[model samples]
Target: MEQPLPKSWSIHTRPEVIAKYEILERVGSGAYSDVYRARRLSDNLIVALKEVHDYQSAFREIEALQMLHNCPNIVVLHEYFWREDEDAVLVLEFLRTDLAAVIRDAKKKEGGIRVGEIKRWMLQILCGVDACHRNMIVHRDLKPGNLLVSDDGVLKLADFGQARILMEPGFDGDDDNHQLPVEQNTGYQENVTPPLDVVADAHSLPDQGFNKQVVEDTNREEYLRQLVELKAKRHAVDETDKETNINDGYSSCLATGTISDIDDDPLKSSYSYDAEEGGDGRNGALTSCVGTRWFRAPELLYGSTDYGLEVDLWSLGCIFSELLTLEPLFPGISDIDQLGRIINVLGNLTEEVWPSCCKLPDYKTISFAKIENPTGLEACLPNKSADEISIVKRLVCYNPASRATTMELLNDKYFDEEPLPLPVTELHVPLTKNNHDEDSPGGWHDYDDMGSDSDFGDFGHFKVENTGSGFSMQFS
Candidate 1:
């Protein structure tokens, strides 16, 4: 018999150890780990370093990450080693922000991730995924978050070596108990399941059920959260029992069919989603995140056990749908209702297609409504062109086999009709002409020649060149 490896393999040194790079502020974090900003002592330039307790989660994949450092689309790995002095550290390219940061900032304006923007994002992701696939790597947790951008406006695929970090269970929320094997949550969200005591403790607290209104049960966070937030603030409690008794004035008046106590709390209570309600909200199993839940594939919603890359495709489709129309394609409170949203729009799965699916772990319990007459493309995206509508339909199709591959989607007619160009390269310019002005750090050929001020939502320099035929980029 072989001796098993330890869980805490090796980690980066703490309190600013100067090996090759000087440690800086943290940029990203995992359930049990943290990533930081570090500067090269030699040049005083910044770079990102991922420090973990060990490499036990990666097994042999560490070699894979080290081998593919040549790929530009990937976050280049600088160096890796166990600080015999402390833990292990992974030095990498320091990107400015992830897609989440970019999208949140961009959404404030009308022009969110546009069709061209979506293409550019998807195209860059395809390049990354294809490269990973070529190397036989599967980024099981690929979301908008994993796609990152640097201050230089370059998009890079992060977490190629993420499997180690993704070793914990996430998506299949119900099955995982407090005590599960390290292998159980592999490929799922990291450390999603709270310890048994935590989950039990949360539910044990009297759930106030639903509010008096019809929307109470229909809207989970909107109603009770409203009351919970209001009650948490303003209405202070003198006694502990009063604080526990949630049937305070908010519900008291709501039940009387009177609009008196429905005083919307101006002091909005922010629900800490990361709060797990365990002993201290930490060390507890989590249900789902608002962001990752958006891209959950239909099979997972329907309770399918064995799934694969198609899950990522489903999320990609959903994200694309949201980007296309600026609305969530399948927004449901519960898994059953989520399936209904999917069925209503994309049509239910035919038995011939999802034949073996009924045998999944959650299948016996979930009885989804089979919508024979689902809505069509016109109904789904009212103003979208035939080509754009068709693309979304294919992407969100229920049959996993029938789902479009990333490559197939990259060549979609929609992107073709509204062609998106890659980041422009000055490779064609002469060596003399290629010289950028020293005044600008990016070495701009002519910074003053750039376009006028942009509208909030429009990021792409979308201007139709007035050639013989018009070339407008805006969607009607």
Candidate 2:
């Protein structure tokens, strides 16, 4: 009897992948994976082969890509396969360069990225971000390096290594009194099958199949439409379920053991600050010391775990500022230093200024040095147009609640300015020449190479481990 052929592409061995696709050269390497420009042997079609060694990061990126594959602004995941304990090979669409290279090249060759080009790139970035947010996923890491730019001038959001999926719709923090009803998809529960349009045939492999069903664009739109309707229904249900706080802004009697009595916790009375006496009685479930120090939000620095997409908006503001000036707005050495730099620019984070500042976990322990005069964004970007100034200000606003969402930025009047954003092809940003051989020079290879210290603050300690085929690096 002859040996049977592998039923699924995923079951194929490493030699099989090499036989089907010819790996030309290693184009890029990072803390977790190595990237190569390859050609499909059958048709000579070019593609990117990413050898992901970290199991957790690979799965996270795969899940994010599955949910966002149909988004045009997001990088397309053509196909992927895992072989036991071996690296998960992800075949992604070939993109010429990254935004970091484009910006760096512009600064070196031209004076700066043209205003029109900036608008175009920013709009596309926001589109990708909005799609992620709509699906209740947050791209926690948003920087120029991670954004890939194709030869056709199309900006695609790449690198979902640090993305997070929200369990609840939006960031309506865990509430006890107002028990919001879980909005279920029509005839679909957590264990139920996907919609008819999204579900594939019975013969199709359920998971980890190379020829898995690709999500169609129409299916994505329909899914989003249903999500919007579900949110509306949830809102209506929430309105009826909510119980009025008769105490209003004041603290309810602790002795009464009412609904607002902090669940009868005796520790509620121990705090020096009282909610009734003008304190922000917020108890957020935030963790400290996460994300890169430089682009970290003020709330994060203050130890506010109750943050949402607004933290990303704050980071974007920093990136937007850097694009214009070619330098980070607040390049702090440490977490405390980062908070100090923010205060130096946006003024003190006082109780009067930000009512919620007092509620942060670290507020009582940490004391930011008072700055005499806060040099605002206007002073920092003197040449920035009024429209640019306005948008950045809203993004890196002192209050996280006041920060604009990605969708809001898309509608801003800034895009309608004189000399409208250049058409995709008209944009004169840099593009890397595709290399397919060992003799080829590394063009834009360092575009997303773990970023520089200037961009991500100092890396404490990083280790590189060598696998049989490639190497994987881990940051401490």
Candidate 3:
């Protein structure tokens, strides 16, 4: 009798045997994954292979990929298969550098951004988010690192690592603990951290009698008590005896992959930095999952139970600002420093903004500093206008409930009257004369509209060029 293979083996493909999809180079890596540039054996098309260690995470990505196949703004997931070694490789469309690298490079060249480019990128991001919302998927993580720019300067949303797939037609993806937060308290309900999620659920639930009784009889006090107990229990493990006020577990998980010895003793880092190391359950990379400290949402940084895609949205807004300013909106050197940075840029959270943060899962440990101090986007991006700042404010609102929705963001005044340029027409990709063969593999610079002859890829050159419409690309 032959041994049976696991259900996951269904998607497996033997790369060694098939002689297709050869690895070109290692381009990217994550906490539990590595991404390589690959070419299709038959079609000779360049693609990206994201290899994952965890089977379930890979499965979840595949599930989401199938749902998002039709969305153009999202990175196209071509196929998924397992190597003979059982390592899963998700064949994705090949794209150029991510926004994080792009912005950093752009900043270094001219030391900042041109307003016109900022407008274009922000609209693109909004379109991407809107597409995700229409598909009923919430990207759990959205940051500069996850955003990739094609060689032609097309911005695409990628990395569905923390994405939540909403069931289409009549399907619901939240059955069992499939969609629950990794750090979700045992007795808690998996309500959406998004304003849309909270509102939709609020309306869906019954308001009278038995439901009322259930709500009343339920010890609101008890659930919080349990959360406190669990948080206490979690803290008690090693550092609990020391009683250091660390926050979420993302930084810690990151450390696990980065450093192993810290697991034993009380390692010393900045207070704010250590706060990030504390994992919020275990949602991010076991190592290097800290995408960007400045882009972290208030809920994740301050500790909120209802945190979810809303956090990602917040990061996107800040990223958009960073692209424009060529600087992080909130570059918190330490965890406490992050709070100050946020307040300085977005204004401090007020009762008028976030009234019930105290009830959140991370609330107890959250130090709600006085609203006496404040941060607003305009102050952070002194070069940006009120309208530009308005867009950021709506997305990065302290109260998750008040944050902007994908739909609302799409309809923002920023895009109210402008036309979004198409890929074939709007992009001005000057293909390198040396790599003119469409069939032959092109180097990174050859494909990039803004890239130079340099190996790292030329970045940050802005020149003003008027378009048919009022909107323009400042690339002179």
Candidate 4:
């Protein structure tokens, strides 16, 4: 017997979406979006409908996915519906599990994750990230939960809500077409007037309870008025000589909820980061407040907005570290503490390591005491071989320029050794579904709680001191 849809889910449903697919259940919910597992009415195929409430996140995800269409390692975006006043609903391919589940399940096994399995997961992630980087797209948020896996064992990169395009192919610094529009700057668009035929079709559809036409008209009018006021404010800022920082418009913290909080409650409120202007004449300055706290790069931790694809490389290193040890490399409670954990292991950030370190936005604002003997990567992965540690060292570093590129890591001899990367068909896919639901345990919402009980003594002892100025570290 078919189960009835919950009444609360009605808030996420739209006449157009209901017209095309049968909503089975709410699979995921976040600050600005809700994902539902639905079956297409046309072919009865299962799909995930991601209804995004934030305009900027929706636009960036749609644009990035469209640009990455047909990339095997990346998530597939089927189609989407966007109305002037309604939240954008994106139709996406549904995967059963993610890397987080794999890691979680591995912890229960006798010998832990197989060498071949680790190699395969790492390779797939590199392939997906390589594709994104080659296309000039920076997946600001990269974590175990975002790496979804199919039943056939193919891992695809998902959740591009925080992605940014540095430049298009053959993009010259002087090209105005590459620049983000004012609408993108303000995170809202003007009302888009639909075609007459589309309007007629919408009216022809049966109403569930309320009058659709009247409701849409009223919302559209009110939204247009608000947009006008926003545009006026934006124009005034543009005319000023003072530089405009993206942080001025919104909060730097993407979400106040911790990993534990998100795991216990998936519907927690979240925040968004705005892209700033100026970055070697590219689209714009990328936001530093991206990715989950644990996997965030050193540059991003110190608030470096003028970063590059290296940020993702740092995240890849963290993910790889977790794969090897089944534990997060640097699991810090807050951004300040996150840096402290890194500095505890990798030593202090100095000008000798990365010359441009002084240019970071919060470099001077946040300071840490020097470490006499930093616990190196080898200490973190105690039983792992030198090759494994070497691979990770190539990535998780203070110097963005020094970090290994995706292509370089892909070509590394690590994948060529015995117990080679398992073939996609032979790879073990966890049966647990990675629906972004409060009840399920394998999605972005659940990452914070993973390995929460692990001992941090392996990285050595370090105390985080709260200097009234900012956070600093004291090594014992």
Candidate 5:
């Protein structure tokens, strides 16, 4: 029998990383990556090293973060390492805690979170999301856990494993004329060259700046060899080990690597909607199987493949609701239960509400009895003022078109009212807790045992009965 590789041989323990940074402790873990708190040996700067096992996710995250490097609300990528045949490692700014921890800490306090503090956090989240949306990127997974807070109370969007670029940066005019080929398996185009401006904007740590040489002479030689090979082929797409299906029980919220192999030549991918076919286009379809069950948008729950930035808006509403109430607004046990919960509150999704409702893949397959007098947002947020309720209402609605954009929400009058959003310096920053605590850095606790998949076993026989006030599921 072959001997198992030692823990020291792990990707995070690569010689290039171990030589330059002192590994402090493992901070977080997930399906595709492991995060560690490390200290740079040269300048003694603390940073998080993310070792990503999945190639495609690493590629997506690296490209997204690089594009949004100048955005204040998005997490900064200090640098990254991606040697051939090795896992990509990202060096990210060290954020002590996340929004989930802040929410958890608020729940323990007497009056819950302060109105001003809530506003500040919400503003930061909106800013980050707005930056992504404006850049034509959609962060498919936008839960509180992915919102990291620095020691100075600055909240930045962190995880981008499920993020997708809607279109090439400058080619936004006509979708019909410029239809880019997309990989059916990965939902991204293969071997597409990145724009010149994007290549020029790629940020990397300066060489020969800090203490001793960051890369040893021997390591530099190896790096140069890899760089030459990468340039020679123009970073050819590696289709091996690609995630073929989005619904393969892999969590989209998993942590991804810091650097990407295809960093220099970012993949150009886009989603196309065919009006005649209802949703999916001939070019390609964006996966609806993204995001956590609770925070997933209604269109995604109903299996709408042709989605856009609006999905993140729905998640933003869910996160804001949790911030206000310290409880998840919709904590459904399964995808079916999730949809049912939405119906129980928002009433049946109809053509009157969303003209494209019938286009959803599962709209006919999974039918629910009409909900009469559905519970309103006011009921869910009884203590919240009308203005607060209105904010949530704009986001959680069935009509994706009606959902408020990040820029619109940022300029809302809610922020102009008394008890205004606290300044970044004055905001209360929560203490970083161990993984065992409920408020782990990246919402680690929330990822465990998120119900079973048995509920989706027989979708053909799926039936949802309206139980007067709520919904109950039955199958035959």
Candidate 6:
């Protein structure tokens, strides 16, 4: 029998290591991974090969892609190879450019991505998000840069490093349990069914022997009163429990100094000029301090840990608007500035708009200049048609619950209106331009020349082009 190859592939072995594949060039890099455009030796077909230094992130991404690859709108994972040095490599379908690059290319053209093209891309994006949500996954980091476009015009959602699995409602394991893998849980035993009581569904209703008609007629008013009281009690209890979990989670993160302790903490603290020392009191999986600065949702801005898929919808709204203007809708320099930019466009968040805003962790601490009667979307997105503006209005809503869902957005009349969504094949985005040179410091083969025993080597040669909105670069 033939011996199986090891998961940890050595990077030091140049052309001889993965003899079947050839490294074409270095394409992109992030805090954790380096991306390369490579060719499969067998077929000579190109692929985007991402070498992730973070083992857990690679594991999370592989798991997510295993479930998400079936969706046509999502990027397809071709193969996964492991490295013995705590690194992982993933092979994915190559695309011409990402939506951010497409947007930039459009700026140089006569008429940027047209209305039909924008609508088409937006629909495809929504389809991808729908796929993730259907699989109980959330793409916490949805941005133009992560949305890849092919030369033939298909838009595929990529980058799952920050993705997460959402636990079902009423699931009793630690609400923050999603953040920790099963192996990491205390006293975790294999093949042991969770304690029935702990996993019981909270929303499941109880049965009664009484007839339905008799009960409704007799207990209508009384039933409503009881229901109201029950809801109030449940809300109070849930809030208190969630608050405790948040505090405990943050305390644990602060103590251990683990990178995953705080959501959005790493990138924000290092990059943002005015980011707080420790993130804004977000704890566990609920508070995803992910998403880029300009595309960040309003709930995240207010430090709400209970946010859900609507947060992504808010980002879609921003991206959709950007497709029209070729600029970020809210170009805030810092978190405070970002909030101010939002308030300037959408107006202040009052009890009437989002009744739960005042309850957010940072609500009491951060104060904004009150602006009466905020400007409408039409004023900000004057170039967009009425239907386009309507969709934008629904996406960037104050209350997360009130935001339009993926399916709802799909069914909206805006899609049915004039300038119908273009077919994917008809869409046009500029071809990718490789700005980095092969001979550059961080270029391809930087590690190949090093001794084979060397685990890793850093040859930093990344180039940045100011997009005027903020620094925009491709991340793997």
- The sequence of per-residue lDDT tens digits that candidate 1 reaches over residues 1-476 is 99754434323424333556677665544432356777888888787766544333222224435444555566665655443333456566776555544454444457655555555555556656544543434454455455666554455666543321111222111111232233212122232331111001111112232112212343433433433442333122211222221211111001111111211111101111111211232222221211233455765544332334455567677666665665557654333445556667766555565654543333443343466777855686777767767767776776665666654554455544534433312001121212223464421122111111112123222233343443322211
> How many clashes show up per model?
14, 1, 24, 1, 1, 4
Q: What local distance difference test score does each model get?
A: 0.43, 0.57, 0.48, 0.64, 0.63, 0.56
Error of 3 at 272 (Å): 16
* Candidate 5 per-residue C-alpha lDDT over 200-231 given as tens digits, one digit per residue, 9 for 90 to 100: 11012121111113235564455445434432
Per-residue CA lDDT of model 2 for 1-476, tens digit only, reads 99865433221346646877888766665445667778988899888877765655566666677677667777877777565546677778887666666665765655778776777777677767777766667666677666777777777778775555654432323222321122211111233222133222111212222121234557655755755554454344323322221122321111111111111110011111112211243322223333445566776666544456567788788878877776667766555556667887898878666655665545654554467789998987888888888888988876665677765575577766665666667666564532223353432222222221222124244455666655543333
| Superior by TM-score: candidate 3 or candidate 4 | 4
TM-score ranking, high to low: 4, 5, 6, 2, 3, 1
- Compute the lDDT for candidate 5: 0.63
- Quick one: best lDDT, which candidate? 4
Residues 152-205 of candidate 4: C-alpha lDDT, one tens digit per residue? 888888888777775421111122233223221211222222111111111112
lDDT of 3 by residue, 128-229 (tens): 775565455666556665666667666677877545554421122433234323221222212313212111111112222012222233443443354344
Ranking by lDDT: 4, 5, 2, 6, 3, 1
Give candidate 2's error at residue 183 in angstroms: 32
Which 10 residues in a row give candidate 2 its minimum summed lDDT? 264-273
> Scored by Cα lDDT, where does model 1 land?
0.43
How does model 6 fare in lDDT? Answer: 0.56
Cα-based TM-score, every candidate: 0.55, 0.65, 0.61, 0.73, 0.71, 0.68
Candidate 1, run of 10 with poorest lDDT: 251-260
Report the error of model 3 at residue 124, Å.
Answer: 1.8
CA shift at 382, candidate 4, in angstroms? Answer: 1.2
TM-score of candidate 6 on Cα atoms, chains taken together: 0.68
lDDT of 3: 0.48
Better of 3 and 5 by lDDT: 5
The Cα error of candidate 1 at residue 263, in Å, is 31
